[model samples]
Target: MAVSRRKFISGSGLVAASVAAFPHIARPADAAATRSGQKPSKIIHLVADGMSLATLSMADQLAHLSRKRGLAWLNLHRRAGAHHGLMDMRSLSSLVTDSSAASSSWGSGSRIVNGTVNILPDGRELTTLYELFGQAGWKRGLVTTTEITHATPAGFATKGLKREAAESIATQYLDRGVEVLLGGGRKFFDKTKRKDKRDVYTEYRVKDYALLNESADLAAAPLDKRWLGTFAASHLPFTVDHTHDTKLAKSIPTLAAMTQRALEKLARHERFILQVEGGRVDHGCHMNDAAAAFFDQIAFDEALEVCLEFQRQHADTLLVITTDHSTGNPGLNGTGLRYGLSPLLFSNLLEVKASFSEILKKLSPPEERDKKPEPVTDPAKIAAIIKEAIGYEITPRRAKLLVPFIKKEGEPIYNLMNTLTCQLGQLMANYTGVGWTSGAHTSDYVPISAIGPGAERFAGFIQNTDVFRHYTNLAGIDFRNPESPLVGAVSPDSGILSPHWMA
Candidate 1:
């Protein structure tokens, strides 16, 4: 099926501009020949975690404006033989699924509860796709912008009751013999940072894994051995910050670099399955940082380009690109009379230099002796900070509205939306023409784009749990995870509990 580009761009002028700017995106005559009727020997699953449809649209717009090209993922929609569809990402416990459950549904062929990885609510452990592939002698790999042990990657290989168990999850990756593990969470492997003081790094090294801690190491490292790399104590720096800081750019590899390296290492094996995640895109959405989210989405697209290039050379590979679920429902709103100013306002996103998290640190920098930094309540200072970081000038009155929340003086109205980050996101929307519905996951049908062998299996509407079956079938494996009787049980009236902030 030909994926539609109608929703991606409206005017013919913009389409022509996109094609002219990125002429290499045009499909080659041999592209159709790369699609195979036989089972795929390799699969590359790419996830832009927490990406809503609007997020993808805005990211494409941003890329056209800044990079002079449309995103590779969106470009795939224009390919004649590619498959495009929507996926229902609801979990067993709730309509709005978290990353763990969303990925678990795909990983285990079962709708597991939120906050859990590959374990049913009733405590039965589901066999994950990674374990099955490993049993069949296929090399496995995971790459992400978040901690390698984060929910999305962990959902594929580990069985745990809590997604927060990073240390345990890291250990599981080593035990499962996943050939390539890249991304952040240095604390999970460093003895000094772990709760139990166990050096998981040493364990990997002892097992002949090539441990990499810096971006430079990745280039020189041999691809013959198992690889484990961690570049941050927690999640890697947001793309916005990483782009601005030279030191960070040198230390941390981009998502595309990690994906390329992972594929090179895995390609050495006869068969392999790799999962690449732009995990921090979800973090950016949760924090309501438009530039952060969009740039990370672009970073995810760069990785998509790497996968596409690999598939062009390797016909037996299956490539499935999708998100776990939607978060924040961020969109560029129509601005001014008849929306004449919408494009101009949306273009202001180019001026954004830092994420809300980085801006907050500057606004409330810690004092000596670890004392909490006093909020910068001065409207002039606040306006100055906003102007410097976001390149938008706000009136003193508008700046003052953020004082109460920043100072923690009292709970503002609409407690959830009133967060300092959310308030900042709202304030910036006037200039950027971006707005967020809520800083939480939504029960929306996310888009799926697939190509190469078995790509047709993902076309049309499908449940999230069905992905596991498709993947297993493509790999010539037949196994069904035990289902919990409580599947589809309505969650208790917890009244929209705040997301586990760090997850």
Candidate 2:
């Protein structure tokens, strides 16, 4: 049945009213028991990197469809005394912030250029939050699905002129004495993969850091020693692909496992701060892969549940959940008559067995001596692969449209967003009803949800730089990093053409 616009609006109002009327908040006695006005002994900052409002909503819907529950993030909003708000995540170089600068704004309390971390445009080095907290005798930890040296995690602990200098960032982490480091980027630490042939693993071991290489290692790791765990050569595989591969599932740990271990290690210290990032969410959004993004978001939600449970037991811990910025602006678009088919189409996401990246690997041209293969351009072969990967059978005509682009022939359609991944994502949308605005970060104000002591400071519209000040205040540290003047700085559009995936 086709629902009128008036009826839809009225129905939405009723749902909103129902939500408001429910006693989602804790009782007055429960509120009194919380350590709201006390200083937090530890702070756990959880970031769903590149997540948008639409992405969060879709993840909630997916959870309801698959698990018969809402996202822990939203559930925290309904039940916990969480302070929900929006944050303006602009960088010094652009209104649409990249991960490095967005993280630096919080890390250094001063906005830097898009591609730099904790370094001003004029070559002045800004002290990072981890450094300051470390100076105040607080232990620091960084756990992410991306490389441990990636921008989001690096921003809190390192100073670098280039965010791409992963090796340098890894070295900085060791020098700065971050007690716990867990993620991918095995290449950055292995002497065989380093350009300079530096054996960083030896250096970390010399410092008494436990170097872990597999999921089983995390369980046996000693709580007394520091940790440096790298399970993949690069960013961890998407959750969808990881779960489907038995070997990968056993070898690599989930984000929740990493978070659990990091928290356990950090909690052993007198005071500590840990940043848990679902970094692959940004990569999935960059590739415009719906299943990859949503599944990773669910994985992030699971990690958040771990943190939430920790916060419940440790009232002196302050937990903050947020995203650096929105990317791809993904949403579920209406399909069929009066949007009747939208829900059914969105449900198809559950059937996706592999990521677009995984599917693209199957389309690679056959090995030959300077000769292109025909299978890449075969519509029948392409459609069959799509059906096997995502459980959706594309029409031959639709598969034909992907030929030229998949072959990298030319920009036939989607000029600016011309890429096989983006094109495939668009094609998949025809069957799934999920669409993306573009495969890049947006200037939208992302949401921030926090609980525990000091969360109230984040309860309204605030600048990204405010995060640093609040953390300092909570930790009883009074200091400010110097900011560069805007005069003679590069234009916001200077590096606008840089790779969107770099974030």
Candidate 3:
């Protein structure tokens, strides 16, 4: 259990700094045996979609800025408690990997073409690991702050059409009989909410099978998984917004709650695979809101705590924490902000855009309503709203910069806000001397930290596809048709194999 990589951490920097710091990670020893010789009975994969090295760095800086001690990923990395290693996250595209390809990399073990999931770059479809796990008799679950049917979770759970089909994904979870399905996105399940307006949840709850809308939900039996629930929609409310709305928060549990119930339900099977994603981290990062991103990661960190605690009780579990890709690549310049401001400490950029746009809409004269002062990008007006709702102020210069980017092409207000948020995190950092770049997904190998069975196999800079091989091999699943070159793994150790360590 002793860490061997501490001495290598000489100075502090981003990915480069830690790369040298932990040179030799302790390989987790092989897990216990079932009827066959395999790694372990449980594997929990925690994917923070769109988490770039910058996201990791921002999470740490945000935690430190907001409070004294920060999150465990930073705290544990700081002290080398968990298994820390880099994962080379390249897609078959090899340029930039979207969530579909990046998550598909993990889902299929082969890097698929950019826009598809579980299918190779050549359009060959592979059965997703979720189905594979189900067939293998292992309970599986997918949890997200976004719709449970979103790209990251759905990539593993089902396949069809494009990632755009949220309704179909919702049906997949129910049809697949996944033990736990938790997240936001009420619209897709509510048929009536659509122009089609089919209330899928009410239908499912009412057991009115005649009204089943999607292909997947037709034959669905009523689910009574004690520890699980599902909501069908695209995105969930932020923690800040959750406080104001009871229906949103009360209707669904937090990611931690889902994970806990998942462990409660799925762990009983003796072998299970669950993927918990803090999907909104990418959203917050996209907007450049450190506060929202930070807290969400904390919410994710809370899930991590639930997992780590659960791991302590169930040693056979291999808990792997990593990201599919990086977004916005936000960061601080190591100066300014006597205190570090976390990425989560952000105002809802969407709210500002909505409010500001509303003010603009009201401003147009009735006679000339069609014409809209190029829309007041006034920072003062923005500051008033943000200060009240989010407790932050924006200067006129920054507010003015927000207009052109947000209003053009009739873009969704959230997109414009997300764009400005990136600026906001950096701008806030400047008061104490912080700077950052605009949004761009980085092609960087995310940090893949593991802490149980088959974990040693994850060490070092391995290709994205390699993860598929190792996870399937350990979980008693199969790889896709296209065989990838084998990347070597670190030998297993006691920590991962310990009977009580369920990650």
Candidate 4:
């Protein structure tokens, strides 16, 4: 079933969407954090990096986006159907937090300024939730489709001078020893890829741990607490290409694959905490690739499916699924290129890009080769497909630009076509009565859902900073330690974190 989006320009709503991700007010720390009425054997943090309300709601309504299966999160909640809740996801700084600040909000239980991690604007370095979990004798792991060093994952594992400081980010994970570190960003570990001539992977001194990057190597060195894997030269390719290059995606793992591996590894301990990040959902939204974005959301839905499955067996675990922030509101609007509603007319990104090239080739004259010429379109087929998809006929004149714009193959006549598609949801907004601004995060209160022990505490409207204390207070994770230096006091310009906090 297709998603229904009214796309209305509602007045100020969704606090997280408007206030930026900083704390306007500071509340007393909840004493219940450490010794709450309930405790879980495990903690699973499922994050969708740029997930907006519209994005998630639309995905949920699509019904078929998750490969014809129901959304992974929804199905799990329905089956176990225990803790339903909401989270106010603004960071301490900007309403539009880059993944780092947003991730740090939950990671540190305190919102630091935008562009900065948990360190305060003054000069203090706060310990992350995982650090607390580790100190409490619980195991920890991180799984992301993007590079582990990327903002969201790094928010949980490392904090430093800059979000761009991937080199240092890679080093932070080396000694801390998170049980399972799966994702892309192979460049950070390889000397050849880094601007600095240092290969951190080779220098990593953990003895006896298997640093495997290929499927074949997994048997040689199974994923263990002592292991760290980097599977791509860059962020792993879109999920569509995972099978094509297994080596890069092998130990790196999918959202589902890593979620399972983390659960399997961490489950050995009496208690464990895991953060599974669907990082590219935001990237796809940024790139304005609907097919890629939608599919990536599907992949995350699969990961949630796996997380929900684990929750079924381990009844005590607290499962919280939500986005750190939303990108442009991708609300679906009614279709406009309705050319007779043909199924073949609306292909995915690759297909659309390819089809446009093929359609143009069929129209171009052999003699027209090296010269700049007017864009041409084969409206006959284009019209038929449009009709199939939306039940309307597009003019051959309109097809001249629209078809090539949509297909975007090789040397095409349009520039910034992706931007156009991202706007499609917004343009249809007026007609559908839904409203959206261009590529930007809105200050809206994000939805937060929780299940299992203390999950009820997450419901009702709350502040973004309250979220930090919610779990920290639940787990009794402390940030204040005389041994630990004051946080956020250090200036960003100093190019260093306080001595006590290693970035």
Please count the clashing residue pairs in each candidate, in the order shown: 0, 0, 43, 65
On the 0 to 100 scale, the lDDT of residue 421 in model 3 is 45
After superposition on all C-alphas, the RMSD of every candidate to the true structure, in Å, is 6.0, 7.4, 12.5, 11.6
Deviation in Å, model 2, residue 329 alpha carbon: 0.3
Q: Residues 357-455, candidate 3, lDDT per residue (tens digit)?
A: 122243222336565345335557755544555444666666555455444423333442344344445555544233444454667768888776677
lDDT of 1 by residue, 21-129 (tens): 3222244534436545667888999999999999999999988886768798988988867899999998887788899988889999998778778987656888999
lDDT of 4: 0.58
Which window of ten consecutive residues has the lowest lDDT sum in model 3? 1-10
Model 4 regions lying over 4 Å from their true place:
1-36, 61-66, 76-81, 205-208, 216-225, 241-252, 335-436, 480-503
Q: Rank the candidates by TM-score, best first.
A: 1, 2, 3, 4
Candidate that would win on lDDT: 2
Give me the runs in candidate 2 sitting further than 4 Å from their true place. Answer: 1-36, 365-375, 485-497
Better candidate number, 1 or 3, judged by lDDT: 1
**TM-score per model over all chains:** 0.91, 0.91, 0.72, 0.70
Local accuracy of candidate 2 as per-residue lDDT tens digits, 1-503: 11211221121222233223323222333331465677788899999999999999998898676555678899877765679899999888778889999899999999888888899877899999999999999999999999999999999999855888899999999989999999999999999999999999999999999999999998799988999999999999998888777788789988888887787777667688999999999889988899899888988987887777667666677899999999899999989999999999998888887898888878865568888665477899899999999989888899998888777774734564777888888888888899988888999999998888888888999989999999999999999999875433455476633576665
Please report the TM-score between candidate 4 and the true structure: 0.70
Better of 2 and 3 by lDDT: 2
Higher-lDDT candidate of 1 and 4: 1
